[model samples]
Target chain A: MIQRLLLLLFLIVFAVSETADAAVKTIVLDGSTTVGPVAKSFAIYFTKKYGVRVTVSESGSGNGAKSLINSSCTIATMSRAMKEAEIAAARKKGVNPVAHVIAFDGLAMVIHPANPVRSLSISQIRSIYQGTIRNWKEVGGANARIVVIQRESNSGTQESFKELVTGKRMRITGNSETQSSNGAVKNRVSTTLSSIGFLSLGFVDSSVKVIAVNGVVPNEKTVKNGAYKVTRPLYLYTNGQPSGLVKQFIDLPNTPEGKGMITELGLVSR
Target chain B: MNIGTRKILDRSFTAVGIGSIVVMALALMIVVVPIVYNGIGAVFFTGTVEHRKMLHAEFKRGDSQNLDSEVASTDRYRAKVYDMLTGFEAELETMAPEKKTEYTAKYAQVQSALRALLGPLPGDPEPMLTRFKYGQTRWEKAEEKLHDLLYESKWDNSNSSVMSKEFFVSRAISFEGTSLARLFPYVKENLENMLHPEFTFYWGFITDSSVDSHFFGGIWPEIQGTFFLAIGAMLFAFPLGVVAAVYFTEYAKPGFLNSMLRSANSTLAGVPSIVFGMFGLAFFINTMKVSESKSVIAGALTLAIMILPTIIRAAEEAILAVPKTYREASLSLGSSKWNTIATVILPAALPGILTGGVISLGRAAGETAPIIFTAAVSVGSAIGLADVFSSPTPALSWNIYNLASEHEAAAQLRHVQYGMVLALVTIVLLLNLSAIVLRARISKKLKC
Candidate 1:
């Protein structure tokens, strides 16, 4: 009985590996959670139109870079451009990393809607995050201890926020609570009376009031016109220039359908 | 000390024991009741016409004819809304540029809120996202969207002594002179006609693959992935664990090596789950080349290792608990030692061994950390059995975290998250229940 069971297990494993070897036209995308929705929407539309299977994984921007370098995924959807070290690593692995700007996202500084402070200069925002300004009064709000919220380090949104608002070398205060995603940060800022956080502009809604940075609100026009200093371009990276199905997918953002999905999800069309 | 004092102490000890049990039960109720309540809402809720329309369009599970009629009825009421919007736009076109700019911003907010409530406005190009393809599917959400349409939520920071308070200002009041002012009251009165909410039981929440990051459809992929991972872990871990237990209990001598092995087992049990996740990624994927990257086989192997110490410990205890008399009698009757151990000792320990297996199975199914680096993907379809070695699939535990904390629409998809939790709990409970029943039957047979 034991021998038969062992034989059966081996057979099953062998059969599965055999079937997996069968070539199917599939495009695999791995990367930033911020870019996941856009990638997924494009995959759905792409599959329907071209009859090819598309799968996406949201591991993180750093891991997406790793996947692309390892040649595990066809496209790496990143909210931030690849770092120098990552590009060097890809080159060492005989992979030529090329980036395609798919869409633009603005990081809106958000607070509880009731907070009287309507805007903050980039310097004031930097001071608040750096733990120098611990109270709302320092930023012209009521006398309450300000609760700082930030995203986990792995998040592409967090990286972009760091580069845009806080200096790259500066550290966020330890007192800040780390949320895992944009939705979580928005949820925290909306519910907490004296909390502040940044979110992708698409996630800004009625629940959280977005405070202007440098006296300019993050909107489609401001982001497009370069008035919104906090905006960053979302990207899809491939090894060298993409070809065939991957090329079609990389070109999705320029298509009307892709642009519509981007706007629908509350991102700026590039 | 007297006899009376002894009796009093005994009574207090009993009371303390019962009190602790009561507290534990209460704690379990506090955690489980809310999950059950909101989880039920995922299936049984007041669904609107849009819900039926979505079901027809996405899954082809509803009556198209009935859905068409529902659409026609809702559209009749919706036409007035469209007309009012057109009238307001026409009214804006003829106004001064300054006035147009003022109304345009506020008017834009109203238009978007209305779109959120009733879906894309008539004559707009079709929305590509499944979430935008339909309006509010649940009547409760519809009412919330309607409130957003009617009122602008504002914060009252008048009291400097406290945090700001939220207050609503009527959008109609803001638009008093415009045709859009009439749209608010009209929508308020005709909401029931526009939505046509009916009590619906959505069994498909369990059976259908999610559409567009769970904005619509079901959680079939997550449920199947969890089953595959848990059962695969058990299949790999059970036999090895049982054999190791037999060696420790029946054959191993009490020596330095045996004690060291025992300590190693305990140490393995105490390792944090996340450490196991990191090890799995490094050892299985990096060193062993397990399917090139994260896959179900790698995840199962990691979980099997995580649960192995527990299974071995439990099986050892179960073997030790079997009475010595049966083995002695079999040996005295001229049966070989191996025969006596297999027929007499093993049969007697099977029930207790199964109890341990069941508990470990539940742990394997519910654990999130070990699989994060090995097997779980945040989003994927139900992969075939053949693809388990190569594909990473969505499991209930990981997706629950993703949907609750990471999904872009986390706030809006609370029901999906709750439903996923309930499904996972049910799956684990059913597994334990079957094992319990099997153990009971086996014990009864042994007694006879």
Candidate 2:
């Protein structure tokens, strides 16, 4: 019985390895939850148009960098550019990470649609996140305690928000609740009257009211025209200059169909 | 300190025991009732004509002739809505510049709301995403979208002392003088005619792969992945765990080393599951190069390690529970030690060992943390058995988290998340129920 079990195990390993070798013309993407939707849509369209299989994994930007360094994925979709340390790590592994800007996403500060406070300066928003401005009244709103919502540490959107609104070195208050994704953050902000959270421009809907940042609203025209101050370029990193199916995938945003998908999802095409 | 006082205390203690059991039962009910209730909505709900259309187009299920007739009937009502929109647009083009500008923005809002309720407008390009290719599939969601179309929801914060309240302003009221005013009431009255909703039982929620980030389709990939991961872990851990248990119960002598090993087994059980996840990544994927990255083999190995201690403890207890008379009778009958253990003790202990195995199997299936770093992906189609070593697949436990908290349209896909939770719960319950039945059958056979 033991011998038969061992034989079965050996057969499985052999079969898996054989199939793995045959798995060409397939693109594997790993990265940001922010970029996951776009990647998934593109994968579906790409498979339909070209008959090449595409699979996406939303493990977060940090893991995306790691996956690229490890040569596990063909493309690493990210909402933030790779950090200096990540580039150095990739270099050490002989993987030259190249970034391709796919689309532009504006980080919109959203609150409950009922909130009296419609706008906040960058510093005021930073102060609220830092816990110095605890009550909404301090920021020209009602006397309720501010419910600050943040994305998880691994999220690229969180990193981008930190860089744009709060300084990278500044610590977010312990009172802030950390949600895992943009949808979760939107859900919280939409439900809680005193809550404030940030989401990608594409996720903004009437469920939550988008507040002005630096006196400019985040919308397609504003973000595209550079009037939106908190805009960031979404990226897809490859090990080197991409080739073949990877090249075509990285070039998707340049195509009309891909551009339409980006606009439909609420991101602006560069 | 009298007999009567002691008897009163004993009765109170028994009452407390019963009270605690009742509390536990109530707590279980509170947690399970909502899950089962909402989870049922995933499979059984009022489906609109759009839903049938989506199924016919995507899954290639349903009667095409019936669907075509339904579409044609719905289109007759929907055409009036489109005509009203065009009439309002033409009225705007002939108005004064400032009035046209004012009406244009409001008209744009009305148009988008209509697009959301129905599919894309006539002049709009074909939507690239599958979600936009069809209108609301579920009647409940379609009603919510209709509310969004008929009225603009605004928060009432005039009195600032309390929380803000949401109130709606009718779009028809705002567009009183315009042709669009008639559109809202017309659509509201004829909604039942426009989208013929019928009670639908979508067993396909269990068998079809999701489309466009679970905006549509089923969760077969997650279910298949969970089964693969759980069964794969059992295949690796069962033999090793049972052998370890037999050695601990029958062969290991009571010594300092044996005591330390026993302590280690209990310690392993107490460690946090997340620690196993981190270790799985560090040891299996990074150091051992298990299938190049996160794969089922690596995840199975990690889960096997996590459940090993429990299996060992349970199997050891089962081996020990075999009546001493059985072993003695075998020995007296001139059987060797190994022979007695193999033929008599193990056979007697099989049912109990399987009970523990079944419980561990449920745990392995339900665990999310260990697989997150090793095997689970947020989105992937059902993988074949041969791909287990190289590709990561979506498991129910992990995808449940992804769908509920991370998917782009999480609010809209609450039913999908609930359905996934129900599927996982049902699978684990069924596994346990089968174990109970198997145990009863084995014990009955032994009695005979």
lDDT of all predictions, in order shown? 0.87, 0.88
CAPRI accuracy category, model 1: acceptable
Query: How high is the lDDT of residue B118 in model 2?
Result: 81
Writing each residue's lDDT as its tens digit, candidate 1 over B1-448 gives: 8999999999999999999999999999999999999999999999999899899888887878888888999999999999999999999999899999999999999989998999899888888888998899999999999999999988787765456777899999999988889999999999999999999999999977888888988898788788778878999899899999999998999999999999999999999998998888778876787766578898999999999999999999999999988888999999997898788998899998888987899999999999987888776666667777777778999999888876778889999999999999998898688678868988998999
TM-score of each: 0.93, 0.94
Question: Which segments of candidate 2 are over 4 A away from where they belong?
Answer: A1-26, A50-53, B1-7, B157-164
**What tens-digit string does per-residue lDDT give for candidate 2 at B1-448?**
9999999999999999999999999999998998899899999999999899999999899999998998999999999999998999899999999999988988888888887778888898899888998888899998998999999878787876556778899989999998889999999999888889899999999878888878889998788888888888988889899999999989999999999999999999989988999899889888898877678899999999999999999999999999999999999999999999999999899889988988999999999999988888876666767778887878999999888777778788899999999999998998788679778878888889
Count of clashing pairs, candidate 1: 0
Point to the candidate with the largest lDDT: 2
Residues A201-228 of candidate 2 have per-residue lDDT tens digits of 8787778999999789999999999988
Instruction: Specify the poorest-scoring 10-residue window by lDDT in model 1 chain A.
Output: A15-24
The DockQ figures for the candidates are: 0.40, 0.40
* Deviation of model 2 at A212, angstroms: 0.9
Candidate 1 stretches with Cα past 4 Å from truth are A1-26, A47-53, A70-72, B157-163, B333-337
**Candidate 1 at B106: error in angstroms?**
1.9
